[model samples]
Structures are given as C-alpha cells and as structure tokens.
Target: MMLLPEGSFDFALQDVLNRNDHFQSVTEGDACVGKVASLLLYVEPVMADSGCLQVLQRFVSDETLQAVAIVDDKHNAVGIIDRGKISDIFLRPFSRDLLGKKAISEIMDKQPIVVDIKTGIDDVARIIIDSGVRHMVNGFIIHDRGVYVGMATGLSLLKEITHRKQRELFIMAHYDLLTGLPNRLLFKDRLLQACQNAKRLGHLLALIFVDVDRFKAINDSMGHAFGDKLLQNIASRLAASVRQSDTVARLGGDEFVIVLQNVKSSQDVCGIVGDIAEQLRQPIPIYEREIHVTTSMGIALYQDYQDSAEELVRKADIAMYEVKQRGRNGYLLYAPDMEQQDDIRMSLETQLRMAIDGGELSLYYQPQVDLKQNCMIGVEALLRWNHPNLGSISPAVFIPIAEETGLIIPIGEWALKQAVQQHLEWIAQGLPPLRVAVNISAVQFQADGFADKVRRIVADSGIDPAYLELELTESGVMSRAELAIKTLTDLRALGVKLAIDDFGTGYSSLSYLRRFPIDRIKIDQSFVRDIHNTPANEAIVKAIIALGDSLGLEMLAEGVENQQELAWIMSHHCREAQGYHFAKALSPADLRSWYAQSIVIKCP
Candidate 1:
C-alpha cells in the first residue's frame, strides 16, 4: 500500500462511478468513514526510474495533481511525490535542468503516514496533529486489509477537530460540572438578556434566588460527595418545575438562581416560587436515608425594581437573607424597607461584638420552680446585651447573628463560666445549692473539643458539676444524634447535668432521646403558653411529661404566666416550671435579694 497526495481524477470516470448504484450502496455501511477512500483519485503510479519531467508535465496539466504515488513493476506501492517538492526543485535557478529529468522516485517521500479506511474521523484527526508534516501534500494513505484504498486531506481532519473543540469549550464555560445546570456566568448572561427582552416587550420578569437552608450543616454532617448529589437532585427538580423558557442556574454551593421571563404579575411569580419551594421540600434519598431540605426564595420583579440585572439579583439575594432571618422554608418579595432593616441588623452585629468585649453583656437568671414542692430549685441563665446607645437588646435579635458570625462560641463559653462562678459565689454566701442551667448554642456544642472545654471551665470555676446544667436544644442534639450521644456521654462523665431545651419544637427521635444521657427535658414555651385554651398544646405538654416520667427524666414547663397554666402543668405531673408567673429574669444582685426574701424555699 502507498500514500498519495490528492489529485484530479478523470471527470468522465468520476461521473460514471457516481452513477453506479454499486459504489453508492457500498459507501452506506458506515456514514462516519471520513477517510482517504472518500476522495480517492485513480491515477496510476510511475516507476522509480520514470522521468521527473513527465511527472512535472502531468502535475502542470491537472490543477488538483498535488501528489502521485510511486510503485514497483509488480504493482506494490513504494513512494510518493507532491507538487511542492517538484516546484521547489524547478523554481531554483538551473536546479530544474539538473534534476527535473531524473527519476520521480529520487524526490519522492519514501516513508509516509498511513491509516486503515475504516479508521474513525476522530482518530484520523489525532494522526494529522501528531504527524510533523505541515501539509500532507502526499495525503495519508487509507488501506483495507493491505490494499490501497485512497487518500485523505489534513485540512478536512483539522476542521472537524476544531469544530469539536469549540463545542466542548462552550459547554465547559456555560454549564456546571456537577449539576449540569447553567453556571453563574451563563445565568448572568441569560438574566441580562431576559431583562432586555422584558423591557422591550413590556412584560414582567422575575428573578428568583433560591438558597437551600442550613446546607452547610448538611454538607458538614453528611460529607461533600452526598451534598453534591443532593445539589444535582435539586437542579433536576428545579428544571422539571419550570417552563422551557425559564432558566434555572446553579450559582455554586446550595444557591440557584432562576429567571422567569414573560411573567404576568407578582401573583404569577408567587405561584411559580411556591411550586419550586414545594418541589425542593420533597425528601431526597441519599445513602439509604431520606434527606429533607427546604429552600428560601427571594423574588425581584423587573419593572417593579427598575434596576440592572446585577442589581436585581442583589435585591433578590437581600430578600432571600430576610427569609432566612424569619426562619427559613418560605419565600419573600423584595421590599424597599428590607434594606434598611438589613442595615440595622448589621449595626446590631457590630454593636454586639463591642458588647462582648466591653463587659456590656450580662447573665439574667429565670427561676425554674419545683411546682410540686412550691419552691424554686434552679435558675436558667439567659444572656442579655445592653448597648450604650441602644439600651437593652433582645437575645432573640442578636443571638442568631452571633451564631452566624461564630461569636456564639465565645459568648456561650462566657455564659457557662459566669453561671458556674455565680453559683459558686452563692454557695460561698451560705445559700442553698441550686442547679444553674445555661443554654448552649448549636455552634458551641458541635465545636471541636467542646466537652473538654466545658470540663476545664467547670474545674476552674470550683463549682460542683452537678450544679452546672447545660441546656441543648432538641434540633442541636438530633442534628448529629450519634455524635451528640458521644458528646453528651462525655459531659455526663464530667458530672454536669444535661437537659434538652425547647423539646417539642424539633423532630427528635425517641430512640436517640433514650440514648442521650439527659437529666431532664424542658417543654418549649410555645406549647406551654396556652395550655388551658389549646387542646393540642395541652396534649403535647402532657405527652412530654409522661415521656419524661417513663424515661425516669424530670420534666420542666417554660412560659408559666398565670395560676391557671401552673395549675394545669402541676395537674399533669410536671415537676418544674419557669416563667413570669413566678418572676421574670433578674440581675444577679436582684435574684439574690429576691431568693432571700421569697417564702417559697424547697430542699431536694
């Protein structure tokens, strides 16, 4: 077999072959065979001793005669010649006269790249790039079982490879690797285009920002691989929930942006947002367990906002953060006033940091009374911040900010140390020993070496560990139940009492609750506030009391504001109660004075 450059073929013979039914049918087996056979020329090869002048004459006669094959007497391919080498020799002064009349084989390329006729177009492209030849004047030879078929051009193969590379580059730039959804770059481009269209057509467009709530917690607890799979699942659901005209894009890590074009009104946007939220809320099965997640969506209307695409997205982001602040699993529309509220929150966050350092934060104690004995037995330490300018700031306002900023870890530690030290001081003053319960933030509880830190603080405080009670919320304990069990057990070994606060608010598995080494459970105030009027609250409170009794753990009801509620709690066998019905949270000095003067004194 021999490689030969592309050459002009006899026009009459090519027409005859084109008209032949056999040739056309034979080419139908594999449509992708873009090889030398498809452009073959039937020109016969000259012998090694053939006149170079004659070959040059033939090349001059045929404009397409770029190269020709050389063969032995037995019809075996040996070498090839191209128009380039012939022109190089002839163009030099006196060189053509010296070498043009010699054998064409003298100037022929003896070794050339060859491939099978059935080789894929892709493989042929790779061969063209790998070969050092700038132009295959003598094109690559295609063979079938050692028989020469035809020649293939380097230009054609390179064009196909360039086209394929362009396509791949496009996909890489526009789509996310993990979710296969449009990435932020493409989303922004599409959002800009959609805004332009909406403005031109006088239609409403809504840009909805969807953020998965507590996704970092999920990712940290379940591992990133599972988190990636969860994102993919979420992307698919979002895609299925929207129309083909709408664009859903992943803005990296638990955040997706959707552009709803041609929306009728805010109501239409609301309906779509609701559907998307519901779709995301559906349980996604991961690693044999169903993982549940909810999305907080923020919608910004194009005409209503009258802003640039980037600004609209920013507004939507602000709204999404507002949803997160109001307790996630819902959607909110962007309002002008929300930005002001955000500024206030930022100011509060700044002031809070200063408060922590300036000793403006103090612990207020709320008495937890032993209702059965009609006496106070313990006090829950609640944190309070009094800013120099803003006066008393509610924990409900600053606590979430602290948690988000990770200041909760230090704040929690301070609260625990202060409560323990205060308890020790009371003991030194000859007062009865009482348990001092301090609420532990989830961040502080899950922190590395937290149990060890608590142990160190307790040892340093010189207070009996039994008097230092740590109150962990139900969601905090159940987030990582197995890990919580280990941590709780370690704290239990330190001799500090452990209790689950805001018990009925979260979904805590009973089996894990049993496994946790808890000394008591505090009924959340929401259930305890209207226990007399709301049958559901009454039943839940009763059930929790019974559950505590069955598990040999004490039950305490919070938010007891009147005799009726206290009577109802005591009637249901609740051992302890805490709320304004007895006394509100008081300063350390005021609490000491109140406890001294109070007629209700109980001993265990």
Candidate 2:
C-alpha cells in the first residue's frame, strides 16, 4: 500500500517501531541467521484511508524506502505499496494529478504476501518464488501477531543467504574433515597471520612441524579405521597442549603443524615442546586397544622476521627430517648448521650422480679371517668415493643420499661388476679362491629384475658364482621378508653365497632366519665393541653365535678392533671375524701382498 501523510502514518510507525530493537536483536544472533526477521527493514507504515499524495510525499522524503505497509485503525497490515508502481503511475503526464487525490487503497495491492517475522528466510523466499517474481518488486510485509512490523526486500534476503553459504563453503575448504583442524591451505594462512602478529608485537614466532613416527607401519598393521581414530586422538591432544593464542593444524596424513606467537625465548618453546611430547606419549585407547604413538617435532623460530611463513615451515620441515635421520621420537630446534648440512647433502647427491661416470668411486677389500686358523678366508668389498675436490667421502654419508635419489641402483651394479672382476683377476693370478663379499643396499635389492641382473653379472664375469657372496643388511631383508625370500631364493639358485650383514642391530627375528635360504650372520660392531665389559653386547654376541650355530650357518664378528674383542668372539665359538685389528680395507695390490703373507703365516 501507498504511504500516508508523514504525520498520519507516524502514530502507526511509532507503535510498530517500538518492537524494532527486539527484531534487531534476533537478526544479529546466530540462532536467527536464516529467520525472516533478519531481513526486516523498519519503514513507516501508511494508514489505509490516506490519499495517494500523502504516499507520494512520504516517498519523496525517504529516498531509500522500497515499499510501505498499509495498516488499518488497529495497526493491522491490509496491503503493500511498491515504489516502482507509484513512480510509474505519477510519471505519466498528468496521471498523478488525476489519481493522486484518490484513496491509496484504491490502487494498492489488497492481498500482499505477508509473512510472520518468525518464518525462516528460506520459507519466505520460497513463498516469493512460488507467488511470482512480481512480488519481489514491492517485497512483502513482515508482521508479528497480525500487526504490521516491517518490510523485507528480495535484495537483502539474497545477500544474507549468499553470505551464509559462503561461510559454510569456507569452513569446508579450510578445515580437515576427520580431525577438524586447519588443513595445509588454512594453516599457511594462519601462519602468515601469526607471523604478522609476532612482527607487529616485536615477539618471536615459533613454527613446529610434527610427524607421527612409523605411522605408515601402524596404519598398515592396525587397519585404516584404527589409524583414523589415532589421528583424531592425537589432534585433540595436540590442540589441548597449546594456549588459545596458539594454532594447531593438521597438514594431512599424520603430519601436523603448530604456530606459537609471542614466544619469549627458546626456553619457552622448549617447555611447550616438552609438554607436547609428554602429552603424545600417553596411550590412546582406540578399538579396545591402547595405541601408542611418538612424534618427531622440528621447531623454527622467527626472531627478527627474517623468514616468511613458507620459509619458516620449510625450515621446520627440514629440522623434523633431521630428527627422523638421527632417530625418531624426539625434537630438534632449527639450527643454522642443520640447514647448512641439508645444503651439503643436496650438493653431495648432485656430485654422486657424476661420480660413477667420472671414475671417482672404487672398491676396497677388507679381509675376513678364520680366528682359529689365523688365516684369511674371504674379503668384504666396501665402496669408497674420492671426489676430485673433496678428498674422501664416507659411504655412511653418501649411501643414504644415493638410496634416496635412486642412484644406488647403478652404483650397486657398478660395485657388483668391479668386485666380481677383481675376484676373477685374483683367481687368474693363481691365488687361492676366497669368497668375495659385496654389500647390497635395500633399494638395489628390491629393484625389479634384481635377481636377473645378478644372474647376468655372474654370467658375464665367467667366475664361479660360489666365489661371489652378497652381503645384505639384516633390516634390509627383514623389512619385506616375503619379497626378500623370493629374491634370496633366486640368488641362491644362481649358486651365489648369501650372508646377513650387521646382524643383532635390526629386526633380529628367528622366523625370517628359518625362512631365508642361506648362509652367515655377521655380528654388528656395536655388539663387538666392548663385548668383554658390556654384558648386553656380550649377551647379544653370544646369542647371535648360538643362533648361527643352530641354523648351521657361519658366524662372523665385525669390528674386531682389539685383542679383547677378538678374544671374546673366539671364546664364544665365532669362527670368522673382520676389523681393523686384522687389516684395514686395502687396494688390490695391498690385498694381494697381504694374502700371500697370510698364506705363509698360516702354512708356517
């Protein structure tokens, strides 16, 4: 309905406007997000008996008024007047003059779509759509207890619904569904915000990267359902471990991140980290099982805003990997040297690529002796690298890099070829035949057609496969025992002698020992280092020797560097041993001389 004279409608408007504050309160709260009252606009209502000129004057005074309510003497809503219709009517030549004096009810909509203020915005929107799109031009009257209260426009309704949908979409995109924590996208955003806050407040920001240790193993063994429950439990504990100002986020899988703002010092971070570690150490009950998990955390601090959010996260990730490398279940602060070490590792990996082609790599022979016979029985071939610029690089440092880079396969092939050729040369020189042991890395062993490659190498060498011994780490074979079993069987079929290297240091299980096809168990150096004094080492060595005896396999003690260590293995009935005490890894010439001397001593 058209508006009445300002003075005439003022009385009705005042009566309805008195309830506007209550309507405002309902619209602003969370519970009323989709309620019709949220879209209510309090426009002065016109008296039903007023003239069209009075409505015209009221529209002129309030330029933003989209529509007006027509109410009766009791303030009951009767009809609605749209601004568009009135403007159209009055704009036609002298139509306003002819119709402006008529009663506003004569031209107004007698039955407008009036919705109760309590109705949902969706319901009212549906009503508008079903009634016709024309109803949106003038909107509709909103009332309470049959009394006209306000008008709700189509524009405001659309915006409110759109805003709510956007909020829902935002939550879905930014949060992890399972853990209900910020995912990587949102974590980066929060980290940037935290960094800004820290910079503004002139305080330190600590970025912590957390990785659940051996999570894949647990996930594979316990089933995905149990793994999911464990992750949720961990998420809850991690959230509880921090303050309200801090943010804990899951970067997917078992990786989580945390941002701590206003950190006072490294000690403050240490205390928080210690608490987190302790919290994670507690057993989590899932599926009637008390599951235990340990985390490796790496913390990178922004003291002077030197690192961006991304750089901070990267540095923390690098530090976390360091913890994994050293051993799992601990934390490491991001040190400058750690980054430097990472750079060096990357550089070494690049250099190793050229190493095989550049002839920088070679093999050295360390003699394995028969302790009782006091004579050499075999030699273990170790890979050595002499970089053109860097004098010598330990296999301990470069082998892992090669494994990670997939460079180990070619390098391993090279070593196998060289060792076999060297053995053939020794035989050609009329030296006594001895088993030449060459170590095989896990990646090179598990590679497709590995056995076939070994067969090809053995055939090409024209040397007896009996003289070639392949030394595999205990953990390397035991990690995937079934695959290893098949591979070992294939190698055994080729008549190559097999030995388990570094025994008693990794998955030392009797089950795999019975299942695997062959030969010797080499006691790791750690067990042999102080075997006479350390009961644990002595016990481990004795157990290995006994296990080898039971399996009808030879037992060789590695790292026998002293008379006491050598005497201890000999007393334990270990027949073979190798270490610096016997002779260091030597060149072919030195090994030939040492072999001749060893034969003379044994014969004498």
Clashing pairs in 2: 1-80, 1-81
Give the number of the best model, judged by lDDT: 2
* TM-score to true structure, per model: 0.80, 0.64
Question: Which ten-residue region of model 1 has the weakest summed lDDT?
Answer: 8-17
Model 1: CA > 4 A from native: 1-152, 156-180, 221-229, 285-290
Tell me the tens digit of each residue's lDDT in model 1 across 1-604: 3543443222322332233132222224646544445544466566778988888888898987777777766555677778888888788898778886688778878876666766765555455545654444466665567655556665555444444445445666788878778899999899999999998999999999999877776787678999998998999999999999999999998899999989898998999899888888888988887877888899988985479998999999989988877877899999999999788888888888888889999999998899778888999999999888889988888998888778998999889889888898888887799889999998789877899999899778778898889999988888678788999999999999999999999999999888999999999999988789999998888888889999999899989999899889888888899999989999988988888887777564
Scored by CA lDDT, what does every candidate get?
0.81, 0.84
Runs off by more than 4 Å, candidate 2: 1-184, 196-204, 211-245, 249-256, 261-296, 303-311, 324-329, 446-452, 459-463, 478-495, 510-514, 533-536, 599-604
How well does candidate 1 match the true structure in TM-score terms? 0.80
- Cα distance off (Å), candidate 2, residue 500: 2.9
Clashing pairs in 1: 36-151
Residue 369 displacement in candidate 1 (angstroms)? 1.5
**Which tens-of-lDDT digit does each residue in 1-604 have in candidate 2?**
4544534323432333232221233124676566888888898899998999889888888898878989999988899888888888888899877987798998888889999889977677667656766676788889999988898886676566556545555666788878878888999889999988888989888999999976765676557998999999999999999998899999989999999988889999989998999999888899876866789999999997988888999999989877866756899999878988888887898999999899999999999888787888789999999999998999878887787567999999999999999998987897778789999987788777899999999988798999899999876787557778999999999999999998887765688789898888888998899789999888777777878889999889999999998888888799999998989999988999987775424422
- Angstrom error at residue 459, model 2: 4.8
